[model samples]
Target: MCKFLQHTGLHQCVPSPAGAAEGTPTTHQWMLRASNSVLMLLPAYHNERVFMLAYWILDLGSKKKKKEKKKKKKKKKKKKKKKKKKKKKKKKKKKKKKKKKKKKKKNNNNNNNNNNNNNNNKKEEEEEEEEETLLKIVPTVVCSGG
Candidate 1:
């Protein structure tokens, strides 16, 4: 979750099948050979040490999705807060009636909603597994000569 950003987070980095050529990789080649572990790459580190001496800088793909998610959550919370405030401002007398109706509806729907709850749980588990999966790493080659 806190690891790789969406674009570099293996949106389509499917593993290459067995018997596929294990040819030496080139710069930013779109291939996924068998690897022990996928090292998450950051743009800054790519330009850290080396030839060309920062002439070309890799654009970092971080914080873009994180900030979006955070903003979305904050917006949801604010909406909930506004709804709560409106409910509080309503007449106290109607609150009792609404509460009773809500409780009755909740009880009536709980049994029929069991399957939906289970499906949601399964989806969450699958997402967690995806989050655990690592992105394939490509090693950068460097040489020095004139």
Candidate 2:
């Protein structure tokens, strides 16, 4: 066990497999430690540096898995938000189109009403002029007979 593991109060250590030749200088020995523990085989020619490297590699693999999970969650949330925004935009566009159509209808009705009023005024003026001409002709006939 490394000093880092011993200092952290992890004293438990599992021995190497019995299959290896006992007392053979060339054989490898396995050891276990607590912090992100892994079964590490230390060759007789190698040092503690190799064991520490293996431990760090295993720890980094686990950390990468956790990061991938978090990224997936964030992507799901972003998709939901984008869908909601699109729905709101579509509704707003529909409302705007309806308002524009109503305004156009109102303007058309007002123009029709103004045209009708102008036509009625012209008819009234023509009728009054005919009445005036009839009155003038009747007075001229009466004066000539007298």
Where does candidate 1 stray beyond 4 Å? 1-59, 92-146
Best-matching candidate per TM-score = 2
Which residue pairs in candidate 2 have backbone atoms (N, alpha carbon, C) closer than 3 angstroms, thus clashing? Answer: none
What lDDT is obtained when candidate 2 is compared to the true structure? 0.63
Per-residue lDDT of candidate 1, residues 1-146 (tens digit): 11222234342354333575333222223212211122334343443332122222221223555778899999999999999998877768687889999999898799659978988999999987876673334547687784
Query: Model 2, which residues run further than 4 Å from truth?
Result: 1-47, 113-146
lDDT of 2 at 30: 26
**Span of ten consecutive residues with least summed lDDT in model 1:** 29-38
lDDT winner: 2
Residue 69 error, candidate 2, Å = 2.4
**How well does each candidate superpose onto the true structure, as a TM-score?**
0.26, 0.43
